[model samples]
Target: MADLLTPGLILAAAATFLFAGLVKGVTGMGLPTFAMAVLGSLVSPAAAAALLIVPSFVTNLWQLLAGPAFAGLARRLWPMMAGIVAGTFAGASLLASGDTGASTAALGATLVAYAAWSLLGRQPRAPARLERWASPIVGLATGLVTGATGVFVVPAVPYLQALDLEKDDLVQALGLSFTVSTLALAGALAVRGAYQVGDLAVSTFAVLPALAGMWLGQEIRRRVSPAAFRRWFLVGLLLLGAEMLLRPLF
Candidate 1:
């Protein structure tokens, strides 16, 4: 139990969550990705992921329950959920082995790949029949990344985005996926001893600023073009990912 609540970490957590929340507020997503990019730059991936536990859980839980698709989502996504849980545990074991350099590289690669796909690649829509075979694979990959880096996007977002659900249903489906990912990641960190009492306290404290920023971002979302905002956000993530990928080389 070193000082997990140091002033530097406090500031990092507050600012990172606030910004992450703001991004989510306007774009309706991106908190985990943004938080990890900012905080992972400042802290270890393990620490950054741990710090995100409270906020991620709190925010995404609301998103998960906002609609009537909970039961439908549960039935359809159970395979993916199961994969996320299992893959998170496996990735957590890798993280706990004290090989953070590898995990960091993996995180960077994930970010770069995701950003590249988002910017230049087209995500293919699977027929609903194919999801049964495809969903678990997507969830497992996303979980491995989430477990290693605390960033919860990658195949999961792309997979969800490709689904032909109605707008509201798509949003809720992502929320459901994220909620499951957050819980799985938290369990992984807890097992690895990276998430302890002090971290939990700080994570709890961080929830307020994250929520407030989301509120403010919601207000600003009305004024900003979502298309423009998305492009900028993707570019920012691309830069962050490139930096992450380059760091180990130097």
Candidate 2:
């Protein structure tokens, strides 16, 4: 594992996690997307995904323990979780077979599109009749991306924001969604034999930076205004997406 931690890579991972965690702390989402988009440039996609597993797990655990809304969220979101499980399996299988370029491209494009729409104030409108059916689609898309790239919030975040749930409930739902999807992805990866002993070891090592970032983010979130946070978060997402798109080209 020491061999895996070159000084430069450690610094890069620390910076990426710090930024990613800051976004999540301020806006209640986007950690994986921020971290993976940055770290994927430095590491293999699979490794990047694996590195996120423990940090996401820890954060979700904290969320669950933080309040009572998890039960309500579970009741309302079971269908979405089901879809995520199925789609994650499919996505993980694809990754395990050693072809992830297409998925990476899709993730990059989706992030860019999402950031643009968000900046333009084009949030998804609440659908009266279609509300019941939307969760499955969001779940499927999120899970597929989660499995492919270890970042699954893109589909669900916009809709979650649009629904205007109470802030506590919203946080609960986001945490539950990420938790379930992460578990599903890990299961899928296991089924596909994507995990190696060394990879697991390296992943454990990655947790330190992630936790540090989370702590730092908590401090920063206290000082930032919501509007300011949103502006910076969108800028970060756009730059992250642009970086992803340009990486393959170069």
Prediction-by-prediction clash tally? 0, 0
What does the lDDT read for residue 31 in candidate 2? Answer: 79
Q: Model 2: residues >4 Å from true position, as ranges? A: 1-5
TM-score of each: 0.95, 0.87
Q: Quote the positional error of residue 22 for candidate 2 in Å.
A: 2.7
lDDT of 1 by residue, 125-223 (tens): 878888888989988988887777777777888888888788888888889989999999888888878778777777888799899989988998999
TM-score, predicted candidate 2 vs. hidden true structure: 0.87
Cα lDDT tens digits for candidate 2, 1-250: 2345688987787777777776777766777777777777676666677767767777776776686677777888888888898889887765566665655665577677777777886656666466678888888888887777777776777777777788888788878888888788778877777765565666666666666767777787788786788777878778777777666666
Clashing residue pairs in candidate 1 (N, C-alpha, C atoms within 3 angstroms):
none
Off by over 4 Å in 1: none
